[model samples]
Target chain A: MSGPAGGGRAGSVLALVGNISARSLRVWQRNRDVYFVTWKTNLVPPLLEPILYLLAFGAGIGALVSEVQYRGEMIGYTTFIAPGLLATQVMFQAFFETTYNTFVRMYYQRTFDSIMTTPLTLEDVMAGELLWGASKGVIGCAVMMVALSAFGLLRYPHALVIIPFSFLAGLLFAGLGLCFTGIVPQIDSFNFPTFLFVMPMFLFSGTFFPLDVLPRWAQVLAEALPLTHVANLMREAALGRLPADLLRDLLYLAVATIPLCVAGIHLMRRRLVK
Target chain B: MSPVIEARALTKRYGGLAAVDGVEFSIRAGECFGFLGPNGAGKTTTVRMIYCASPVTAGDLRVFGIEVGDRPREIKARIGVCQQEDTLDPDFSVRKNLTVFARYFGIPAARAEERSRELLEFMGLWERKDARIRELSGGMKRRLAIARALINDPDLLILDEPTTGLDPQSRHQVWDRVRGLRRQGKTILLTTHYMDEAQTLCDRLVIMDHGKILVEGPPVDLVRSRVGKEVVEVEGYPPGLVQHARQSGWTFESDTGRLFIYTDSGEAVFTVIAHQFPSERCTVRTAGLEDLFLKLTGRELRE
Candidate 1:
């Protein structure tokens, strides 16, 4: 085979896409089988996380504060943060799945090495991982939505759209997490991204409060985070308000997901295809 | 009628160093072939190229009459590989491992189940089909790896040190199953540092060191040609015996505390050494593949 110098940029990308086959779904199937085996433990976290956040921040913290102004309307603090919790769930589920879980499979378990010996290529394995990571996000969002809706924190049919939206948001964060997984020297190196990237997004993605409260520079920085758009979309959907800015948020996520996913696959191929 | 695998000047280079430097060999359809070498001797690298797990740096490599680089998926689908490392899925049980691996080959679920049962039975893992991976012993895990490799009923099986870490009983068990596969007309390619394993399993073998083949032939022929009919070992270094052996133009090697002398007639050499060095201990035994291996590769620790 010719080295990287022989193939042009577009040609190599086309070749990469061409190498991916339906066999990738087998990787997804493998992960799904494993998830089901310990599903009892898996279900507990997503189900209770949103409720705890609602009780602590919504009931306890919301009791002291009056109605918060969101989208120029007075709304309960619990209602305000419910959609943000859904957005964070999407982020956490996909990120953790692709980062820690994928690393273990690739490095420790040698799962990727085993799969490569079959008809499946590295590209197929990464594609399957991205899809599976996104699927985890979708599953977590569904469970959290059920818990949030029980407390009357979510609107009817509009809130249902968050399930599908979570998949897209999931792909974005999964891709982002996989990029880090590719570059990190070891498992312990994940602490860098977890603290510097994920923790900041968790607290400042307008999850607990509106972005208007932050400093002007900080508000712009928050808007740049992928979780910010995810939270904005979830909040609008939960409140049953179909704002025109919905397309802007959707377009931003859709556009960002493709490159990050592609780059994630590319970086992983460099690590694996040696 | 054609060879199952062919490599002409096969080379695999990582950065400035070449792991497999211009090696050439071909494997026939039904014979059991082996690449014998020490650690970092490029045995695993050569097999990796044949199975398309690693990209060849420069070579004309073909498997099943197809260029490996052009259509790896086609080559890989028909070839089963048991890598040197334990690549079995720790998440699945004995049976699920085979069934899940079958999905990668596009094997239908019904067929996968049927094949899984057949393989587990063949490998003697049927009883532990539902047991978790961690619960199984090391031998069981290796057997399960072999069973998983056979899920596709591949025409050629490539095993890289299949019994490296197994106990003697476990190693013999794996060897028996491998021989069984060969009896069914499946071609096999194996690489191992264990000379006895190669002597037992390989029909045609090559001794490799520093990524180059030193010798290639059947095990018995290699021993007879490189290491004569028998070997005489004396317990300690006897300088007079060594001088006499050299002056007589005998083929021998000396180490710190032992001396090995090779001869066609074990009794003659043993009698002479015993007569000359009455106090020195000596034993004459038939030469084997290990003698030829050490003679060719030298007895040095490889990292």
Candidate 2:
């Protein structure tokens, strides 16, 4: 009869979302010491990775090609690689927040199963997971942006747009992370995705080197990637530049976001509800 | 009293295996109904379908007369389930677990807190309310799980193997709480393999084996209707003990090296057993739920 698909259900959904947010906030507040521990164990080490990359790749490789043209503007090799490092940090944080932490809740600890027997539906579970991933991504990416600014690699008007772009980066990877957890056969299956999907995207998504440097066919493959659009968006926003195909890049990311989120929620419902 | 739960030919199949096959029963209001079966006899599966956690492969199921397939949320709102495993969120403290679940049913924070505190005190967990779940023992965790299930003050309470792996002392404590709930006139549907548990707690039960009901009645009537008046259990392999008991006019059923001799005089059979197999361990007891279960479904392990 299509009865009672009323606005009342929407109010209930909002209440569900608020409940999950408050619970997470309380957990974070009570476990403030855990944030410090995670910083020491997970966040601090990766902050050094970009510095090492500059020393090893930028300085070492800059000798052969002192400067490169990206889209239109000319920039030094070290400057080109630095902003890409920030994008990589966002990707990793978003991925880790949903996949690793949520996996423990889903399988090892079974925390979500416990939540499901209550009034919370599968939709609430997915929303909580995605919200946590986005939060972690924002915190991690902000730190990286601050670090880049201190190093003089990031500029003002262009940098103003990076915050929103970082949110998109978080959404993209958070959605992908849920899909990954759903399909992965075992914990060890993550190794193949990291090495194959993550590593290649980090390397070939016009992050380290400009897309024009690649052959025409290789450039086609690069444009097909979700992170390529994200890295391009970051570079354009951070360096005050935009790709000639800006609308296409936005369209590519939007396509990735909608489907990944829908797929993620579907798989999460199957796993958590029953 | 109107029936609180009615399931007709309810079935569930995983892959090609029929886990719950054509299970049918109705639980009356304010009565304790149990599904007594060994492992893999589809107790949990049937419970899952009734709660609408798992979809029924084929059959009709209704809780509080609301059809499950058509209105799951309506049905779930009136039921509380304590699953076999303790699935509490280890990240949250004991108190947070109750309030978090209570909010799922759309309860306000103020009311949820008030009810959470009440339920925690009811379950004797008020002192440890703020402690993380990882810190609690098995028995404490199970009790907390039960408290969490009751947060909504559900009309129908369902438990799957409630006291599965508890010490005798802890089992008794949980049983007392269950009895209290029964006194409060909450309808309970539980599943367990423990015969003593069934005999002690269940007002009526269905003895199940291989996804089918073998018999159903009150605990005392089930024993009297299915088995003999008295029973003697011989522990060791008493060679020729079954034959000797039969020759002495006592009916016998041998199960797992334990011979169950049924007769009007339990002490007479015990005397025969003691005189014939003096070295063997034997006990003379009233025929109870265990004998009825063994008589309906043989002693072979289901799994």
lDDT of each structure? 0.91, 0.78
Q: Model 2 chain A: which ten-residue window has the lowest total lDDT? A: A25-34
- Per-residue CA lDDT of model 2 for B213-278, tens digit only, reads 888889998787667679888887556776676677767888667787776688877886688788
Q: Which candidate is the best by lDDT?
A: 1
Per-model C-alpha RMSD: 1.2, 5.1
Residue B78, model 2, lDDT = 80
DockQ of each: 0.76, 0.28
Lowest lDDT sum, 10 consecutive residues, model 1 chain B, at B269-278
Docking class of 2: acceptable
Q: List TM-scores for all candidates, in order.
A: 0.98, 0.86
Best by DockQ: 1
